[model samples]
Target: SMETNKRNYFGISQGLIKFHPKQQYCLTAECIEAAAAVLSKINQSVDPCDNFYRFACDGWIYNNPIPEDMSNYGVYPWLRHNVDLKLKALLEKPISKRQDSEAVQKAKILYASCMNENKIEKADVKPLLSILRHSPFRWPVLESNIGPEGLWSERRFSLVQTLATLRGQYSNSVFIRLYVAADDKVSNRYILKLDQASLSLSSREDYLENTTEAKSYRDTFLQFMVDTAVLLGANASRAESDMKSVLKLEVKIAEIMIPYENRTSEVMYNKMNISELSAMIPQFDWLGYIKKVIDTKLYPELKDIGPSENVIVRVPQYFKDLFRILENERKKSPHFCLNSFRGVFPCGQQESLVSGTFISSKQFYCLLQIHSPLSLV
Candidate 1:
């Protein structure tokens, strides 16, 4: 009887241990769902040892087809799309005095302004024309009616001054892009850096290469520029002729530019003061340009920018070649063909101004608050 009781007690203890929550070999619903998601992306038919990428991603590729508008689709773009949706939701949320930070409130206001299509449609091109009527923004191409014989003086059109105005007030990078960045060597102090401006096409190769695709791209770009000029009230025949000249100039620029593969840090990192740079490329006033750009009403303290200031010229050869091209263009067309070219490809507009600069949404919102209060309306 004692032996029987002991056996029964031992059996009861074993059953209790098997039924315990910690001891049970079962997964939660959340874990099972997560596992299902991971498995769905994997193709069991594809051997991992032979082709790991295919084994892991074949099923996913089969499930997600590339959209008609997209050139390609991938995980990064998917993640980016998700992030954009989240950002849109956040930005669209109603501004609450209790919950919103200053930056958030400002962002909400800016987003709201952007979304108000009715206000935008009513305003039309008046706002843009108002901006263009300003001194530096007065496009020479559009100023045919202003000057004697419908010709603006080349003397008044200072390349350095124009570049400064476009870069500083308008945030346009025409040919040379100038910005303050941490010294590559020092990595502590900031110094002005000069780089080749981006082209309409993706690469210099697109302009210089003699291929079917390159020719197609060049033709398309020329047509686009001509159309833009026509839309902006330029004479169609003159616009076509001028845009062709601009395209040729860009091609020359592409020919001189250092290819991406050859542009090593050691090769491109040529540091010099503004005076030395001026001596090297005497066509443009480096010191005056820098001073004008930095000495803004917003930053009154940055008034003493001088020739002695050091700068990093990333593409020295490109600048040398560019100045030569400018000299040739100046000799060929006294009024500066490029000056007229600006009307066809006007900078300082929302689209052109935003390129080549990296700014977070919050930072951009803050900038809008400081510079153009109307942008936040």
Candidate 2:
């Protein structure tokens, strides 16, 4: 009787009313806001069916013009800028709380030191001069007594020793870079690896090419080196002449180096023991240099890295060519300074601060662990 009453109703005659539950809209306020934000970036005028990228990104491209200082701008650079800003803010914060981590405190100190331009300026060349006056870094170009009468002693200038000092102390990789890394073949095990050092210019192509840009780059670099030498007490004329030789030597090195394109994993991966490597390239005392580097007070446990140690020679040909170049250069010039100018350069001080921050933070963590709260209590 109820069903008959419903069927006899006025709307039910035209089948306008149904018993099914009403359909509900699923979108929330937040969902609608997000959709609006996405839609705002799209150019409705440009048909997405014809050119999707232009339709999607036209509004964004119009809004964010590239800066004058930047050659290009992209998502990665924007992300990096945001991250750097966050890091700067974090580092600028003062260490007040007693419970604050030692690592955070050390990072704040390092950042403060870096930011203290007044102190750095006051210290001036003194810090660099101190480093230059030290054993291996006492560059003959910088020394007042270096000339025809008081030439640099070849006996005292051991390439191996100088290289070791640069690599170990300053972390400056000159002609060759030696470091411990995971074995390519056996990813689990760590082994020593040697590779060609980076060039002053961006690439070997910069030196090899005869283009106008290449020539300009090379000339500017030469002039810079000459100026650096002159600033460090070298006679202007002599510095110019000597730096020309160094530049020429670098060009030759560039010629011999394996091009990055050709240096595939298979081509570069040549694993051999230190003894075998020494036999292959006998110009330098590889074992002795490695021993000296590892035997430092910082790493007393690594004193006896010997000939039996396995090493991966990334570029065997580069080493062979490098030794030949070294021999020729050694015979030609008495003073062999490799990137010694870096010590006095103002840029180097800033670079050291930035580069050493991570290392300093790690050292702080180690010290904190050694003197933990339990130990202190």
Candidate 3:
């Protein structure tokens, strides 16, 4: 059976490449292997002029079948699989030498913690629920008993401070995204850049399109959001109502958002001083927000950041439109819009196990984002 399996490749793979009579080169192992590799993957049955891809790749396809877990497969995937296997072996190895860095050791510990599924299952939602019970993160839809810290405080909420805390502490991005990178125009030095962020749903079409399937997707998405919130101790009626507003807000946002096709390098290069940015978009505190997000401990040299700091504002129009929408929403219902901003419901880790039944497709991917984040769902 083993020999039969090996015989599945092209006949050229079974033999070595013979040298011409006048050739002087030795038949080294590396040379032989390299020659065999090119020959092995050629499908002699197919003509190269017609369906050259199949002619070249047929042997490889027959030899290396796609894995059950993967949606697609290729040579790169096979190479990556090998690299991951090697990395896994390295990470699993115990730290024995003083030469090993602290980061390396910590990575191993994290890998071990992630691998301990029994402990994860036992601990379950307790780890994430504790995070949700705090200020700025408190979901109003949650039952007061389970969410014992009382409801979110509107009086204490500051949009700038909340944005900073969410970014600094949990590494979440909501309306605005702030990150450091080499200036797009001036390719030498790095500078902070502000841009628009993602929404809860994967596709923009789910929010934008008016088709039956699109409407169905939105309904499915909304129902999923409601179900996740209800599962997290929120009343079904309240969750459905609250989530409707949240979804409505997101749809408005989707309408205003600039599509991907328009975001060219030249179009996005709006480099200006932090003072200019504040003057332009007075709704947000530019200096204060950036200062709060930056970790002085890690970036001690960046302690000198101030109003004069030149930063790139990618989507200036979006910010203006966003605040205008928010201003209108606030005028209409003061507490309602602010409350919606803080109504964050993170999907639990073990949704199925927690409810003692499979949670199904409602357990959406991390667009509410990877963990407990301060983004709209």
Which residue pairs show collisions in model 3? none
CA lDDT, candidate 3, residue 59: 88
lDDT for predicted candidate 3 compared with the true structure: 0.67
Which residue pairs in candidate 2 have backbone atoms (N, alpha carbon, C) closer than 3 angstroms, thus clashing?
none
Looking at candidate 3, what is the lDDT of residue 325?
Answer: 81
How displaced is residue 37 in candidate 2, in Å? 16
Cα deviation of 266 in candidate 1 (Å)? 1.1
When superposed on Cα atoms, how far off is each prediction in RMSD?
12.3, 13.2, 9.7
Give the per-residue lDDT of model 2 (tens digit) for 26-115. Answer: 489998898786777778788555677988888767766764323245667566556656766666677866966886787667667756
Q: What's the number of clashes in each of the models? A: 0, 0, 0
Error at 75, model 2, angstroms = 10
C-alpha lDDT score of every prediction, in listed order: 0.68, 0.68, 0.67
- lDDT score, candidate 3, position 86: 70
State the TM-score for model 3. Answer: 0.68
TM-score-better candidate, 1 vs 3: 3
